[model samples]
Target chain A: MEILMVVVVGVMFTIATYMVLTKSLLRVILGTVLYSHGAHLLILTMGGLGTGAAPLLSTEGPHSDPLPQALVLTAIVISFGVTAFLLVLAYRTYKQHKTDDLDQLRGSSDE
Target chain B: MSNLLILPIILPMLVGTILIFFAKNHSLQRVIAGITAVLLLILAFYLAHEVYYHPQQTMILELGNWSPPFGIVLVADMFATLMVILSSIVGMLCLFFAFKTIETERAKHYFYPFYFFLLTGVNGAFLTGDLFNLFVFFEVMLLSSYVLIVNGGTNYQLRESFKYVVINMIASAFFLVGLAYIYAVTGTLNMADLAEKVGVLEQQGVLNVIAIVFLFVFGAKGALFPLYFWLPNSYYGPPAAVSALFGGLLTKVGIYAIIRTFTLIFTHNTGFTHDIILALAGLTMFFGVLGAVSQFDFKRILSYHIISQVGYMVMGLGIYTQLALAGAIYYIAHHIIVKAALFLFAGATEKITGETSLYKMGGLLRSHPLLGWLFFISAMSLAGIPPLSGFFSKFALILSGIQEERYVIVVVSLLVGLLTLFSMMKIFMYAFWGEQKIPTEKVDKKETMGLLKPIIPLVILTIALGLSAEPIFQFSLGVADQIMDPSNYIDSVLNQD
Candidate 1:
């Protein structure tokens, strides 16, 4: 199960990299969203899968590491806020330049 | 009294939130921010004293009374306190400078709140004991900076800031990936516990890989050689006040994290890890200075120089000796003050001439001699001229480099210093020495003095830090000793009540 989860994370990261490398502004932002999801899943899988027990640390039975869940939750919220902000920024950039294509919106060319 | 450790993070956070309420009342916001800056400075100094004077020389505050390796902690060691103090000084001056210069529109857009929240993030990152907490603080800092950078909402700012945010977000995702791996390897997110465990863990290959991942995550932030593509353009988009703060304090936070993690947690594989850092440091300095030399704009040159100076700070860490680390600490202090002041000078020059390109302005020495001379002093200090803070810091770094017998980096650093001086002199000759470009009527002495008012203290500090390098170096050496021995930080953290 853990190996499958790791394979899923690999695919997510691969898709994220491809999306981020594209020229469109929206794809890049979505790519980052996907990238963060991949990271969150990796953190969870690396923490080990649940083994027929709850995640409570005080319990005696086999249990998941509660820490990664907490970490992923924090990471998810942060990435959510960041994704929202990035979308708004992209919108503003698009409005000003009249293009969602990042190449057309090239900023401050190196002299 | 250890609870006082939380003040640096919480105070600015609280004040920043309150400042949000007075978005339109600019004067009230400035007054509140001014008092907060002063108070933060005082608090930082008091905490520095407390940390240095503490018996074990580390003030540990376990949050919610949860002991370390189990819950979060805030450790105020000597190095962290020094960073807090230096940042407060820069923040106070930059905030005050923003008071006079930040446009009313920008101020109305919650600039004060963003500034303080940025400080909150910076201070929190410095003090937090948990690896995951560092990521959270980094986000807090990045989010505030994103808002601050786009405050003016120029088409250019929007365009530049989008890439900045995107790149940082991607980097942040990887930062979490690194965190996850470290947790998987050690089963602890607390830095102290990680330090203890990593030292004993015989899994050298995975540990080295994890260390490199962190270096990459932090290297991007610190504006190292290849990862610094986002810096120059993004920094150029902001107003001088924001860029000055970012130029001075923001990149240093990344360097601080690199130094802390490398020194404390990732000590087992120095041969593999530190060598890569040293090589990167040399290339970072060489290429960074070359970029500065090619730039004709005032702020652009300053921005490029920021990357190169970062190399020197990392070089100290890469050398990894008591003297070398002490020099790195001293170099960080000097670079923070000097770099911030140089950026302010760029801002002040723009205020007078209404131009940023070097070719467009000239004869500023004839028009405003004080500004010219002061900028000259800062430029010289930046180029590592004698009897200034920059020179002494470089002196210590080079001295230690030669001692370490790392001759290639030593040569690269010396060559970089020469180029730094040349580029600085180019700025002086083109902008201040030639014919007067700005009409005399346009040069407002009163306003220029207002801008320079906040910067003069930094100039005084660099000179003071230079003249009194002995005692200061001694203090930083004490810092180096405290940090170099991970046991000192680890035990005070994990074994604390």
Candidate 2:
């Protein structure tokens, strides 16, 4: 199960990297979202998937490590905030520059 | 009290949140932020005194009364408190400068709130005892900086900040991955606990890899070589006040983290890690000075100099001696003051001449001698001239380097110093000394003095830091002693005393 989770994370990271390399602003935002998800999965899988009851209630035997879950949840919320901010910034950039191609934004103000 | 550890982080957060309601009222925001800045300054000094008097005790505040290795802890030592005080001083000066300079349109967009939020993040990052908490504070700092950087929404700001955000986002992701790996091995996120665990663990291959990952994460943020391409351009886009704040505070936070982690958690394999840091420090200095030498714009030269100065601080860390670490601390404190003052001076010049490119303006010495002299003092200090903060800081670092037989880096450092002086003089000769390019009649003396007023405290502080180098160096030596031995830190956090 851990190996499968690791494989899934690797695939997600690869896809995210490819998307982030694209010139489109939306794609880049999506790429960050996907990348963060991959990281979250990696965290969970690295913590080891335990066959036990949920952490809140009293369990008969061992319980899964709830720390990574808490961490991932916090990370997910933070990334969501960042993604929303990036989308707005991208929208603003699109409106001001009249194009979404990042290549055209290369030159400094001296030009 | 252990609770005092949270004040530096909490106070700014409270003030920033309250300032949101008064966002539309510029005068009110200024008054509130001013008072808050003073209060924070006092609190910082008090905390510093506390740490100074009680050097053996590390103040730990655990949230919700949870024990270490489980609870979130805020740890305050001499080094963290010193950084807090320095940051507050810089924060106050930047606020005053922003009062006179930041446009009303930008102020209305909750600039004061974001400024305070940035401080909260910085102070929190310095104070937090857990790796995950550091990441959260970093995100807080970055999010607020994203707003502050593009506050005016200029085309240049938008263009550059997009790249800045993307790069930082990627770095933050890597930070998470690094944390994940460390947690996987150690089963704990608290830095003190991790130190203990990693010390006991024999196989350090994974730990070393995580250490490099952290190096890259912070190296990018601190503008180290190969990861510093985003800085000069992004920093160039912001208004001068914002630029000053970022230049002074942001990169230093990264360096502080590097120093903290490298000394404490990753000491298991310093032979490998510190060598890498030293090599990078050399490259960072050489390449950064090269970049500075090639720049003609006033702020751009200063921006490149930021990268170069960072190299010196990291070099101190790379050397990893008591004197060297002390020098790094002093260098950080001195660099924060002088760099911010230089940027503010650049703002003043831009205000008068309406230009930032060196060749476009000249002969400011004839009209604004006060501004010219202030710039002269700061520029000289930045270039490591005698009897200034920069000189003593560099002196200690080089002396320690020579003692350690790192002759190559010492030579590179001295050469970088010469090149630094050259670039600074380039700014001086081009912008302040040559013919009056903008015409004297157009210069407003009163307005310029108002702009120069906020810089006066920083200039005096820099001079004082140089003159009183003994006491300060002794203080930093104490801080370095604590950093080199993590037993006290871990003990205090775990309540093992």
Candidate 3:
């Protein structure tokens, strides 16, 4: 299960990297989103898969590690906020420069 | 008061959230931010004194009264408290300077709030004792900085800030990956607990990789060489006040994290890890100065210098001796004061002549002698001239390097110092010398003085730091001692009832 999860994480990271290296601003933002999701998955996988009940003393003979789930939840919230911010920023950049192509966004010649 | 540590983090968070409501009220925002900056400064000094003089030399605050190993914690050792003090100094000065210079339109867009929020992150990063908590604070700081960088939303700013945000976002992701790996190995996120557990763990090889992962994450932030390509250009996009705050405080936070982790958590394989640090420091210094040497614009030159000076501070860390770390600490104190003043002077001169390219500016020394002389003094200090803060810090770092027989870096440092002097003089000669550019009638003497006012304290601090280098270095030696032994930090956090 861990090996399969690791392979899945690697594939996700590969896709994210390809998207991030693309020229479009929106693509770059999505790439980062995908990248963060990969990290979150890696965290869960590294924490080890559990076949147990929820982490309540009364209900569980063996309990899942609550910490990685908690970490992923916090990370998801943060990534959500960051992704929203990135979208707004990309839109603003697109509006200001009239190009979402990262190459065309190079600084002015004299500056 | 053990609780005092949390106030520095909390006050800024509270004030920042409140300031968002009053962003359109310009004078009120200024007054509130000024008062808050002053209060934070006072709090910083008091806390520094308390932490410094306390026999334990480390203060631990576990949130909600949770036990340290299992719960969130804030740890302020001598090094951490000193960083808090430094950030407060830079933050306060920059806040006042921002009051004078930041456009009302920008202020109305929640500039003051984001500024305070950035401080909240910087202060929180300095004070936190949990690895994940550091990551969270890092995001807090970076989020505000993203807002600040593109606040005015110029095309240049948008382009640069996108790069900045994406790079930082990527770095933060890597930070999480490092956290996950370290936790997977040791089953702890509390830094003290990690330190204790790692000390006993036998897998030095895996731990070494985790340390490098952290170094990479922090290197991207700290402007370490090979990872510093984003800094000079991105920094050039912001207003001088924002740049001043960032140039002095932001990268240092990365270095601070590097110093904290390497000294405390990743200590078993010093030979493997610190050697990597030393090599990076050397490259960072050489390449950073080279970047500075090639830049001609006022802000651009100073922006590149930020990358270079960060190298020296890390050089102190790379050496990893008591004396070397003390020197690094002293170097940080000096660099923060001097670099902020230099960037403010860039703003002040830009205020006068309305030019950023050094070649187009001249004869400022004739019109504004005070600005010229003060800038010259700071420029000289930055170049490591005798009897200034810069010289002593470099001297101590080099002295320790020689004792350690790390001759190559010592030589590289000396060469970097020379290049630094050359570029500083390049700014002085091109910008302050030659023919008068702006007519005397167009210059607003009062406005210039207002801009220079906040910077005067920073200048005084750099000078004061120089003159008192002996006692300060002695004090920093104590800080270094506290840092070199992770046991002090681990014990304070974990043994508390």
Q: Candidate 2, which CAPRI tier?
A: medium
Q: Scoring each candidate complex against the real one, what DockQ results?
A: 0.88, 0.78, 0.85
> Candidates' lDDT values, in order?
0.92, 0.91, 0.91
Model 1 global lDDT (CA atoms, 0 to 1): 0.92
Clashing pairs in 3: none
Q: TM-score of predicted model 2?
A: 0.98
Q: What local lDDT score does residue A26 receive in model 2, on the 0 to 100 scale?
A: 83
- The interface RMSD values of the models, given in order, are 0.6, 0.8, 0.7
Candidate that scores best on DockQ: 1
Model 1 chain B: weakest 10-residue lDDT segment is B436-445
Error of 3 at B34 (Å): 0.8
Q: B80-192, model 1: which lDDT tens digit per residue?
A: 99999999999999988898899889999899999999999999999998999999999999999999999989988998899999999989999999998888889999999
Once fitted onto the true fold, the runs of candidate 1 whose alpha carbons sit more than 4 angstroms away are A57-60, A108-111
lDDT digits (tens) for residues B1-497 of candidate 2: 37888889999999999999999999999999999999999999998888777756478788878888798989888888888998999999989999989999999988999999999999999999999999999999999999999899998888888989988988888888988899889999999999899899943788889899999999988999989999999998888888999999999999999999998899877789998999999999999999999999999999999999999999999999999999999999999999999999988888888889998889999999889998999999999998999999999999999999999999999999999999999999999997988876675778887898899999999999999999988988888899989888888787554
DockQ of 3: 0.85
How many backbone clashes are present in model 1? 0
lDDT of 3 at B329: 93
Cα deviation at B18, candidate 3, in Å, is: 0.7
